[model samples]
Target: MSLSAPVLAFEENSGLDTAESAASCALKLVRHDALSKADLSAIEQLAHQPAARHSGNVFFAPRAVAASASLSRGSIDWLLWFQDGRLCLAAPVVISRIASFSLVRIWTHTYAPLGTPLADKRLRPDLLFEELADRGFSALACPLLETGSTLATAVALPGGRQDGRAGFWSGIAERAVLTSDWTEAAALSAQRKKKLRKMQRTLPLVHRVLRGDAARDEGFRQFCELEAMGWKGAAGSALKQSDTALAYASELVASHGAQDTLAIDSLEDPQRQGNQSVAMVISFEIAGRGVVWKIGHNTDYDAVSPGYQVILAASRRFAAENTPIWIDSLAGPEHPLVGWLWPQRLTVGTLVVPLKGSHAPARTLSGFYQAEARLRQVARALRQRLRR
Candidate 1:
């Protein structure tokens, strides 16, 4: 499918009013084989709203969809629901052939994150599943639902017909949430604090949040390069190494930057005037919350623990913000780096709904898949035990 041009315009508005409008307005669903210009614009607008969650403007953006779809052998469907001329729910569905049946996912493999159809808490999500299946989707999978997300309830069918199953696939969608009283020093031990203090005194490092276009662009590019410098680069998974990734990152900065959603925090080394950045973090503000999406640092500065320093500075900055928002370390539960610092683990799960309804065959297939997944998990645990 041919993708339309990228649209990055989004304006913040009152959530209550939007929800009310969505509840009362007439709903209509429009499906396109390829992403249409109007749908792209509407999707971005929905993504920027307070109702959206995790990787809101980044993964569901037009550029992201195009990139992910380009690399996958699947069909793309840009589905949008218009309520009284306003875009209410935008669901980008990817359909891939799996054996004799087709598998449906809210997202393609191009993007790491996925999003469900945007809807108010009052809406019944079963309607969503029925509509998609009526339109030819074999099954609908929501792979990125937060533990307490409204989608979990919104998509539920009446009469206990919500036959979908949700499971916590560790390392799938984890986050670190910090309270108002969170402190950088609290995350580090006394010995580590002393060492960090010494590093800070030696170089007199400065942490700044870059806001200007040139500065933000440079910071983002530097972050990509820094990520490419380490294991990600060696493993050929770095964003800087892929043209599609470069474009997606560029669009994220442009779109979110315009709305003041994108934030680039950098730890600078004055001694290295030519290369001031020792560590950097790329984060975005959503619904008054901060989501730290990426972090990178120069390995050469490991002696000073520049990576930890940068994270500390960013966390402190979030704490000091007048808005009183919590910072979410998007790193998963098993992340060795951020796990030690942020003790809290956000619960996330995936909801799978069979479009064909809960038939005997569908039930059997679901049971088989669940058994297979459990076997894999058990085998993985046994391997870890053996290693120990």
Candidate 2:
């Protein structure tokens, strides 16, 4: 299904209202097809800005993921709101039937770690939820929500109604925003200062930093090589054993590029010769927000902590630009990196609403949600371990 200019068709009684608000206008839900190419381009441009919220989970944020999801059997939709015609909120909604329970389930980029609604920081949760409910969705499921997100707070309110019967999965959303003054970051922690000092001393010994679109291809290869060596090289690891997983990573990288979000910062070791890209950090630039996607280093260089050094360098670059961007190290709270870095935690939650008159049985829906929560718990545990 090639969605090259799809029109958005809303069902009658669809909760969304196109009416503008004087205080905080009504929420608008536009289908993926209804968005114009220019609208997409504008959103993409905002995503790349140094201060915008660039979430990979949003359908329109990265073209590759959006296109791939569109082709899949799963029903994927996009929701957005405009303020005086300016894009304010954007989220990708994936609807699927839980095979065991036969219940309709909706999620945003289930495969990724952080799935926050990409919207203007000023957006209100009540307004957003009212729009969502109007669209005919009874519940919203957000796995890997940060600890204190406005969206999470909104969903847990009276109108939102929390489902206490079904236990929730918890994950940490580690984030730190770069300020105009890079030096202010030093106040964050003594350990951060120590690491910065060590990296500053060691940087001259490693290869130079690779920047911009010109270096992306080579940088991507280095990132993959480092990633493979770090995790996939381990026995029975998913990345090593699953071709689909590898393809997924490659697809994300490719799609980010097609959508102009791919950003790489790498360090080569000139002292050690021949075809080895020792340390690399891959990040996606969205809405001026820098999301740290992945980082890897040659274990051989563990003594020097090359991976840590690469990240420090990248952070400094953003700081130097004086950009109000957050380095979203989207990891679980238990992860050592998250704890040590001490990034702010934002909470997110899943909202499940039962379609009142669906043909599907209720028992089926209950079982599906149960299984979903369990699966989420397992995934969270594994992710926490990886951060260590």
Candidate 3:
């Protein structure tokens, strides 16, 4: 069947107003390809709201949403809850199912991390979740949800939970962020600072802060090349390894650059042939906060610790221009360099909310899946331990 333009549909008792009126409000499900001009405008407006200020900008805009869907080879459906003609809650989901159990998952990717749903202050998440339960979704998988987030207070799956149940297969989204203090030389240990200084003096290192669409695009292309020359290339996981992934990178950078939120910083070795870049870090500024989204480094410069030098310099520069908001690294928890650099932790895990009046079979299926997730976690833990 051909996809139609974005259509707004009403559902009973879905409003965020009084309990009665809220139930009668409409919940709009707009497919990514079907978003209309009006829908985009509302989403943009909703993105700028104070409540959404902390949610990363990538998942809020039309271009970012479309790019993620295309790059990840997944379809996105935005579940919208509106009150008084204004958007109260906006959740972008990629639907999946297990036999009878349908799930609405917050779209995520290895390259791009997504935050929680964008919901205004007036909207109650628990009530909205219940409403979704009525819509035939057996469960909700909110990955990349920060720990202690009140927005997604529902029960969690087999991954990390507040109750201290640690699953072996749990993945943590520990966004590496730098505080304003990191920009200061005093923030570094005496040995680290001295090493950085020595590297700067001995190496013909050139740092360039690339801005605007053209420069950002150029940097992205260079980044792909740089990453492909490293371990990721051999591992077949670099952006250039897949056309779709590359397109997604291009789209995301272009979108963020157009909004003036994209920042690409590169550390080049001027003395080297081709003026090769030693390290490059891509970051996005959202609501005065910086998120260090991606980093690529030339393994040839591993001896010089090019990634660390570049990231430190970039952090200092970013801190100077903007009030240093916490810059989330979006790196894995056990990242060697990033973990050492940023001592603070932001926990990320999956949340599973069983739909209202969920049947026993569906709940049973969820339990089975959770068990499998736990086993995977255990295997992962064993691998890490053995590697050590």
**TM-score result, candidate 2:** 0.66
Write candidate 1's Cα lDDT for 1-388 as tens digits.
Answer: 0012111111223354655654544434333436667667777667666665432424455554554555555656665655556665666666676555556666634334435455443443444445556666565555555545565554433443423331212223456666565667688899878887798777777888986585457878788878887656776868888887777667666656776777788988877867588788887775555567778888788788878888878777777773556456655555556777777666544455556543333334445544654575577577556544
Question: What's the lDDT of the predicted structure labeled candidate 3?
Answer: 0.66
TM-score, cand. 1: 0.75
Off by over 4 Å in 1: 1-41, 53-58, 82-86, 99-102, 108-111, 114-117, 156-174, 179-181, 322-327, 359-388
TM for every model, in the order presented, reads: 0.75, 0.66, 0.81
Candidate 3 residue spans exceeding 4 A from truth: 1-18, 70-74, 148-150, 153-175, 180-183, 273-275, 359-388
- Models sorted by lDDT, best on top: 3, 1, 2
lDDT of each: 0.60, 0.52, 0.66
lDDT of 1 at 21: 51
Q: Write the per-residue lDDT of candidate 2 for residues 1-388, one digit (tens) a residue.
A: 1112111111222254535342445454445556677667656654544324433333335444454464446655665565555665566566554443322233344335465555554444445444555555544455554434434433344443343222233222234434344443653477767776785577544545554544456677666667777744663453435565555566667767665666677777666677456777777665455467777778787767777667666776666653555556655455544334434543444334333333233334434545665687797688657756
lDDT of 2: 0.52
As for TM-score, the candidate ahead, 1 or 2, is: 1
Instruction: Tell how far residue 220 is off in model 1, in angstroms.
Output: 2.2
User: Which prediction has the highest lDDT against the true structure?
Assistant: 3
Better of 1 and 3 by lDDT: 3
**Tens digit of per-residue lDDT, candidate 3, span 166-228:** 111123445566665664554588998888788777775888988777556688888878888
